[model samples]
Target: MNEQEKVKFFEEFNNGLHRLGRITLIAASLLLIAVPFMIGILNDVSPSGTGFLSGFAKVGIIYIPVAIVEFLVYAPMLGVGGSYLSFLTGNVTNMKIPCAMNARDIAETEVGTPENEIISTISVATSAIVTTLVIVVGVILLVPLQPVLQNEALLPAFNNVVPALFGALGLKYFAKSPKIACIPLLLMALLCIFVPAAINQTSLLLLPSGGLALAIGYVLFTKDKL
Candidate 1:
C-alpha cells in the first residue's frame, strides 16, 4: 500500500518471476534439444514420413508446402501477439516484434528490449555469407579428386563445435577481466571440463563455469585496496 511496501512487494514479485523464467528457459532449452532427436527418431520409425523424402529436392518439395501454409497463417499471428505475450508475461523480449508497445508499458510489462533480434540477425547473415563462400571455395579446391570425402556424411560434425569454441572464448574473456580471485574461475573451468566428463551432457558444465566466474569476481572485488 505504502512506498516501502510497494518496493518490497515488487522486488519479491520480480524475484519470483525470475525463478519462473529460469524454469521456463530450462524447459525450453531441453525441448529444443530433445525435439531434434525426437524428429530424428520419428524419421527412423516412419518410412512414410521424413525418411521417405529422398534427396534435397524431395525434401524441399514436401517442406515448401507445409512451410508456406504455416507462414501464411500461424506465423503472422505469432509475430503480432508475441510482443503482447512478452509484456503480459513480464519477461524480457528475447526477440523483437515491431509493435505498438511503449517503453513504460514494456518496462512494467517486459524487462528489456530485444538484443537477440539484432545479434541473431547479424550472426546468421554473416554465417550464411561466409559459409556459402567457404563451400564454393572448397568445391573448387576439391573438384579434382576425393569425391567421397566431399559428401555430407564424410564431413565432420560441427554441431557440437559451437559450445567448445564459445566456452574457450568465454573463459578467455573472463580471465582477462579485472578478477583478482583465481580460485572460483579455476574451479569452475575445471568442473566444466570434468563434469561433462563424469556425467551426462546439457549444462552440467555451467555449474563449474558459473561458479569459477563468480569466485574470480568475488575474490577480485571483495578483497579491496590491499
Candidate 2:
C-alpha cells in the first residue's frame, strides 16, 4: 500500500480504539458504582447521603488535582490507547508507566512515534493482565503464604519496594543526563530531608520538580549544553 493508505488506515484504527476505550471506561465506571449500591440494597443498608458527600469531597479535594496533573503528564508519553488503558486499569505511576517505559527502551522506539505508541499500549495491557493474574494468585495463596509475607526479615524489603523500583528505573536516565536531573533530584532530596512531611506529599511535589526540570532543560537546550 501507499504511504497515504497506511496513514489513513492508522488514523481509522486510532479512531476506533478511542471509541472503544471511551465506551469501556464508561461501562466500567458505571459497574463500579452500581456494584456498591447494589450490595447496599441487597443488604438492606442505606448509606448516609451527607456522609457520602463529605467523604467524597475530602478525597476529591486531594485527588482531583493530582488526577488532572497525572493525565496531562502521562497522556503524551502513553499515547491514546495506552493512556486509556493505563487510566482504566489504575496503576499508571507504579506499574503501567514503568512497563511502558521499559518496553519502549527494549524496542528502541522513540516517544510520540507510531512504534512507541503500539509498544506502550501492548506493554500496559500486558502489565494489567499480569497484575490481575498475580493478584488472583496472591489471593489464592494468601493464607498459605501468611507466614512468609508477614516475616519480619522481609518487612524492610516490602517497605522499600517502591523506592527500589523507581531508583532502578531512574538510574539509567540520571546517568544519561545528570545535568537535567541533578538539580531537581537534589532539591527534592533536600526538601524531603528537611521537611520530612514532603515525602508524603510526593504527588503534589511533582509540579515544582517537573517545572524546575523543564526550565533547566530549556536553559541547557538554548545554551547547547544538553
Candidate 3:
C-alpha cells in the first residue's frame, strides 16, 4: 500500500478502537445504575431500617441533615484520602479528583470560570462514582467465584483510589496557599494518630474531641499573643 493508504487505514483502525472504547464506557455507565439494584434483589436487601445500605437509606430518607452532619464531622484533611490511594497504587491516577478544598478556593485557582466549575464538579464526581462502582462491581463479580477472594483484593485498590482522587482535586489548592492550608490539616493528622483510641469507646465523643481540637487550634492561631 502507498503512504496515504497506510495512513488512512491506521486512521480507520483508530476510529474503530475509539468507537469500541465508547461502547464499553457506556455499558459500564449503565451497569452502575443496574448493578446496585441487582445486588439488592440477590441479597434480599430490604428496608430493615438497619444494616449498612438500609440504615444509610433510612437515616438519609428520614433526616437528610444527619447525613450531612455526619460527613462534616468525619471529613478528612485535604487530599489525605487520595494520598493514601496514591500510596497503595504507586500510580498518580489515584489523584484524579480535580476538586479543590472548597468552591471559593477552586474559583481562585486557574480553573476559575463557570465552565471550569462545571468541569471540576464533573471531574471529581466522575472519579468518585467510578471508584465506588469499581468496589461494588468487584464484589459482585467475585460472588460466583466463591473462595478466590477477588473482593478482598478490591478493598485496597478502592481505598487507594479514594485518597488518590482527593489528592488530585486538592493539588491546585495546595499550591496556592501552602501555609494557610496546613494548620487544620496538621491538627487533624495529630488527632487521627493519637485520639481515635480514646474516642473509640463512644461514637459521639469522637465528634466532640475532633471539634474541640479544631476549635482550639483555630482560637490559638487567631490570638495575637499566641
Candidate 4:
C-alpha cells in the first residue's frame, strides 16, 4: 500500500491493539490479585487487613517508582505493540529488549517506524515463547543439571550473567555512538566503583543516569557538538 494508506492502517491496527492490551492487562491484574485472596479465603489464613495493607505498601512503594521509570526509559525504544507484549510477558531488559533491538538491527528498520514496531513485537513474542520453553526445559533437566550448574568452577560465570550481557551490549552501542554513550558509561562505572551500593539498586540509578545522558545530549545539540 501507499504511504498514506499504510500509515492509516497502522494507526487503526495500533488503536485496536492498545484496546485489547489494556483489557487483557486489567483481567490479568484482577486474576493475580484474586488468586491470593481466593487461597486465603479457602485456607482460613487470610492476612489481617492492616497487615496486608502495610505489606502491600512496603513493596508497592519500592516497585512503583521503578516501574514508572522503566516505562519511561523503555517505551520509546519498544514502541506500541512491542511495549504491550513485552510488559505483559515480563523480562523487558534481559530478554525482550535485546531481542527487539537485535530484530530491528537485523531488519534495518529505524525505531518508531511501523516496520520497527512490527519487528519488535514479533521478536519480543518469540523471545517470550523461547524463554518459556527454555524454562520448561531447564526445569525438566534440573535434576540432571544440578551438579553441573552448582559446580564451584562455574559459579562465577553464573553470578556475572547480567554484567556480562550488559558489557557486551554496551560495547556494541558504545561503538555505534561513543560520544553519547561515554558519559553514562563513565558515570555508571564511577558510581559502581565508589558507591558500590549503586550496583544493588541499578533500577533506581536509571533515572539519574538517563537524565545525565539526556542533558549531555541536549547540551551537545544546542552547541552543535554532536
Candidate 5:
C-alpha cells in the first residue's frame, strides 16, 4: 500500500479496536458494580445506597486525580491499543508500562509511531497474560506458599519491588536524555527529601515534574540549546 492507504488502514483498524475496547470495559465495569448489589439483594440485606455512595466517593476522591494524571502521562507512550489493554489488565506502572518500554527499546521504535503501537500492544498483551497466569497460580498455591510469603525476611524485598523496578527503568532513560531529565529528577529528589509524605502521592507530583521537563525541552529546542 501507498502512504495514504496505509494511514487509512491503520486509522480504521485502530478505531475498530477502540470500539471493542470501550464496549468490553463498559460491560466489565457494569458487571463489577452490579454483582455486589445483586448479592446484597439476594441475601435480603441491601446496603444503604447513601452509605455506598459515600464510601465510593471517599475512595474515588483520592484516586480520581491519580487516574487522570496517569492517563495523560502514559497514553502517549502506550498509544491507543496498548493503553486499552494495559488499563484493562491493571499493573500499569510496575508491569505493563515497563514491559512496553522494554519492547519499544528492543524494537527501536519511537513512542506514538505505528511501530511503537504494535510493539507496545504485543508487549502489554504478553505481560497481561503472564500476570494473569501468575496470579492464578499464586492463588492456587497460596496455602502452601503462605509461610514463605509471610516470612519477615521476605517482606522487605516485596516492599522494594516497585522502587527497584522504577530505579532501573529511570536510569536508562536518564542516561539517554540527561539534560531533559535533570530538572524533573532534581524536583522529585527535593520533594522526597523535604516532603517525604509526598511519596505516597507520586501520581499527583508527576504533573509538575513532567511538565517542567516538557517545558524545558521545548525552550531548549527553540533556543537551539538542546
Candidate 6:
C-alpha cells in the first residue's frame, strides 16, 4: 500500500482500539464496583454511607495519584492497546513494562512508531495471558506447594524477585549511558537511605527521579556529552 493509505489504515486502527479500550475499562470498573455491593446484597448487609465514603476517600488519596502517574508515564511506552491491557490486567511495573520493553528491543522497533505499537501490544497481551495461566496453576498447586513456598530458605529469593527483575532489566540501559543514569540512581539511593518511607512510595518517587534523568539527558545532549 501507499504511504498515505498506510497512515489512514493506522489511524482507523488506533481509533477502533481506543473505542474498545474505553468500553472495556468502563465495563471492568463497573463490575469491580458492583461486586462488593452484590455480595452485600446477597448477605443482606451494607456499609454505612459515611463509612464507605470515608474508606474510599482514604484509599483514593493514596492510589489516585499513582494511577495518574502510571498512565502518564507508561502510555507512550506501551501505546494504545498495550496501555489498556496493562492497566486492566494490573502488574504494570514488574510484568507489562518489562515484556513491552524486551519485545521492542528484540524487534528493533523505535517507540511511537506503528511497529513499536503493535509489538508492545502483542508483548503485553502475551504477558497477561501467561500471567493468568501462571496464577491459575499457582492456585491449583497452592496446597501441595505450601510447604515449599513457605520455606524460610527461599524467603530471601521470594522477597527479592522484583528487585532482581528490575536490576537485570535496568543494568543494560544503565551501562549504555552511565553518565545519564548516575545522578538519578545516586539521588534515589540517598533518598531511600535517609528517608526509609520513600522506599514504600515507589510510584511517587518515579516523578522526580524520571524528571531528573530527562533533564540531565537533555543537558548532556546539548553539551554533546551524551
Best by lDDT: 6
User: All candidates' TM-scores?
Assistant: 0.29, 0.64, 0.30, 0.61, 0.61, 0.63
Q: Which parts of model 1 have CA positions greater than 4 angstroms off?
A: 1-154, 157-160, 163-185, 188-202, 215-226
lDDT of 2 at 67: 97
After TM-score superposition, the amount by which residue 193's alpha carbon in candidate 4 deviates from its true location, in angstroms, is: 24
Which residue pairs collide in model 6, if any? none
Best by TM-score, which number? 2
lDDT of 5 by residue, 1-226 (tens): 8888878888998999799889988998899889988999999988888977866766576678779999999888788888998888898998888889998999999766677788998999899999899989989989788899889999899999999998999999889888899988988999889998998877667667867888989998999987
Tens digits of lDDT, candidate 4, 1-226? 9999999999999999899889988998899889988998999888699977866766676678789999999988888878887888898998889889999999999866899888988898888889899999989988888899899999899999998998899889788767788889888989899998888877667667767877888888899988
Supply the global lDDT for candidate 1.
Answer: 0.49
Count clashing residue pairs per candidate.
3, 0, 9, 0, 0, 0
lDDT of 2 by residue, 1-226 (tens): 6778877887888899899999999999999989989999999997899989876766676679789999999998789999999998998998899889999999999866667888998999999999999999989979898899899999999999999988997998899889999999999999999999889987668778877988999999999999
Stretches of candidate 6 off by over 4 Å are 143-226
Cα displacement (angstroms), candidate 2, residue 196, comes to 22
Model 5: colliding residue pairs: none
Off by over 4 Å in 3: 1-110, 145-200, 224-226
Task: Output the better candidate (3/4) by TM-score.
Answer: 4
Per-model RMSD to reference: 16.1, 7.1, 14.3, 7.4, 7.7, 7.3
* Model 3 C-alpha lDDT per residue in residues 6-30, reported as the tens digit of each score: 6677567546645764676567668
Q: What is the alpha-carbon RMSD of candidate 2 to the true structure?
A: 7.1
Better of 1 and 2 by TM-score: 2
Per-residue lDDT, model 2, residue 37, is 91
